[model samples]
Target: MLTKEFDKPLQILDQDGQVVGPLPPNLAPDRLLEWYRMMWLTRFLSNKLVALQRQGRATTWIPSNGQEATAVGLATPLLEQDWLTASPREMGGYLQKGVSPAAVAYFCRGYPPPPELVGKDARCLPFTIVIGTQTLHSVGLAMAAKMRNENSVVVGTCGDGATSEGDFSEALNFAGVYHAPLVMVVVNNGWAISVPSHKQYAAKHLAMRGIGFGLPARLVDGNDILAVHAVMEEAVANARAGGGPTLVECVTHRQAAHSTSDDPTRYCPPENLALWETRDPLKRFRRFLYDGGYLDEKADKALTLEIEAYMNEEVQRAYDYPAPAPESFFDKVYAEPTPRLARQREEVRQETGAKR
Candidate 1:
């Protein structure tokens, strides 16, 4: 029987969507339905983003198709005041923190989020494209919060590939030494772009790395939202209570090409691909909701269609936003441009022949 000991990767729901262990606190049927909707929205919107790339409307996008549960579960337990610092493929976290779908659409099209919608609106950080860098950023933020005696806890996430980065190691080391109020989550999808994880490390589970740094750690089923959410709640609570940083390794799979620019079929293992398809997080969660009488076919279809229609409208709105100017990159560097940046900005403007 499954137990709270969590000696193995925790799994609350099995392949058939049957509960195999205890549910998390306050997991009412309504909340479960809400969680399912978020997962669906993430996958549905993410698939449309992939299409945007194919149609040449977007430069490229990171697809989070098979990893919905980890993204959603990782963000669910976080308070409005807590921080969510993430690398890309975390659409669910953005939406969970009340990010506008239109803003996400705008960002995916290579534009900054309209400046008005950030700051007080959400504690979530802008998407970081450079792998593993967000880990350090979050750790630094948490250390600052600790110094100021604030209650915020920072949650940082990265792909399995980031574990090899010097930044990842340094961030973990710093957090451990300082006991920063941070939680680091590794969305271990078993492959780093074209490279399988076995080639990256000899350790069986990435969670063990945390133990090496004197932080609590757990390996959880990333597809099992119940398990993921519960584990994240404990980690977040631990950090908030001054217990220091905790590391969680969520084992999931990337269902699509790493990004619109890469091709997975060239190297992804066929047998493993077939296996993970059956473990699709959205399907599994939807089935759990159905079995528990929280959802019916008609209700599911209606909600999904509503979201689908809204997605198109929002994406179109994103496309309608004026394209970014060539020199706009220098605009946000500081409250006022540094003298050197002002000169460089002027040079770019002259080269582009952009009218003043």
Candidate 2:
């Protein structure tokens, strides 16, 4: 019912910081400030990662520049016992779920994250780089929770491009059939690499796809922190109450290149980028806080400086950490190395003068 009425991206706060729709209930001023800080922190970390990549201290950094609110909003509401399976670009979710900044930096450097940073007991999985595969992982985890009578939900996130993958469809069908406690979040950031949404699917909104699977679906303004948090809170609550999975399409823009390896100038026009700039999530939320008298210029400057110092310490620590041994890759492939693989490993060790 709500999904049908608000099929377009739902927005409570307009870009100018005025309420255009009814605000979500019980969102106190303190909670709003917390959400703002989370968004700001996510953006700050993303920007710093981009800089680290450009400086050659990090590798394959995926920019979550314009999607911080989507990441933080969807994740912040989840209970600590709940699990999250997210795409590589969902750094805000990872951080909110207790993944440390140093671990994120380690991830950017292509190194294995430390145990604590990898969410060993935090119920967060490593960032899923294989796109829609995490959808199935989320379904399986939720199914397991249901079997164990655990009151936890699995929140799976993927890009809109992933919706086209067979894995996404299969996971949705299974989750629907089993009535699993899961929340599937599709971040529709306009472009899936070089392909735009128009080329990705024929549906007016990706949320419609969940209708056939008998799941409640809604589209939320990914750029609006309050609206995103409100929608996701409802979705998570429903799943926890045994109402089955909910598909949420977060409509936002990809304000940066797909990754450090991408050249957006080849496909993304200047006009398109210029337009989304006006709807920038951080700016919109900051304006909202300012207008409400929750945040002032002095506080904003102080917060920025604090976040900068925190990131500087974490980034330097990550840089100083030792790189993983190249030979360890060979060790983990099998219980017992095959003769040919053993010979190859020895050859590499000999070539690199690496000790066992």
Candidate 3:
């Protein structure tokens, strides 16, 4: 149920990097550089994480190649006090929230990864493996904030595929009823694994789903960082002002496989991937900066080198952390081991000699 006026996604910059709308909010002289840096770091982090998976250092990893704008823009506007429930591919959010690239790389190496503490006091949750579960967690955090009379707003992010989950619906319903200070960002990347978005729902945008739950829904060009940042700023402000939850649908495309285990070439069309390539978020933003004379060739090349060296250090640091012990799960599940847990621990010890 999208109104005719809202049918089209909002755009602040065209694919060629020309401004197509008013200037995005928070446009300080250095803000553009900061935004581009975060996006670049995210892409590099993704490549490194995916490489780890392929190198047998990690089992699988999510990539955020095409959705850089959606991840960074939405996360950039958030304050340190605010909470963010992360989606698997929002590596930009993790980096922006003060979680080190090394910590992130290390997290991927652990089987099943760590939960919640992945970001610690940074207020960023670990990358969620269960699709829409973070939505509920966000609402709960918002409610707790309200109860404590704290002004912290909570942001929960998810993919279009997660909008179909019952937990998402429930989260929306509860947030609406309580007027929780929350922002819900749904990135419609056109495919849920091999399933095309056309088969997911009849609604023109996933934001429409929030409308039914009493949330204000907005659609933005996910590939355009300006548009994504502007819309996110507005939504976050609204929620912080006690205006209730707002849902934003970021229209983007997943340019690569869903994960290291996925092969999009088998099910996704080449034409579609090629089309999105022309709309790469980082490319468009970089072009805009160059056109505006905000970024010179020297600065651009320097930043590229800086990011490469920075990420290399991060990857090396990630390697410094030892892998989890095989029997760590049993010993760390609780302070005192129960009889059943002891038995399980003994069984694992007997089988693998996992001593520590």
Candidate topping lDDT: 1
Each candidate: what lDDT?
A: 0.86, 0.85, 0.84
TM-score of 2: 0.94
Off by over 4 Å in 2: 116-120, 331-345, 354-356
lDDT of 1 at 217: 86
Backbone clashes under 3 angstroms, per model: 0, 0, 0
Q: How far off is residue 128 in model 3, in Å?
A: 0.9
lDDT of 2 by residue, 235-270 (tens): 999999889899999998888899988899899888
As for candidate 2, its clashing pairs are none
TM-score between model 1 and native: 0.94
| Residue-wise C-alpha lDDT for candidate 3, range 97-145, written one tens digit per residue | 7778877887787643444424456788767899899999999999899
Report clash pairs, candidate 3.
none
Model 2: which ten-residue window has the lowest total lDDT? 1-10
Q: Candidate 2 at residue 72, lDDT?
A: 91
How many Å off is the CA of 113 in candidate 2? 1.0
lDDT of 2: 0.85
Model 1, runs deviating above 4 Å: 1-7, 117-120, 336-340, 354-356
**Candidates by lDDT, descending order:** 1, 2, 3
TM, every model: 0.94, 0.94, 0.94
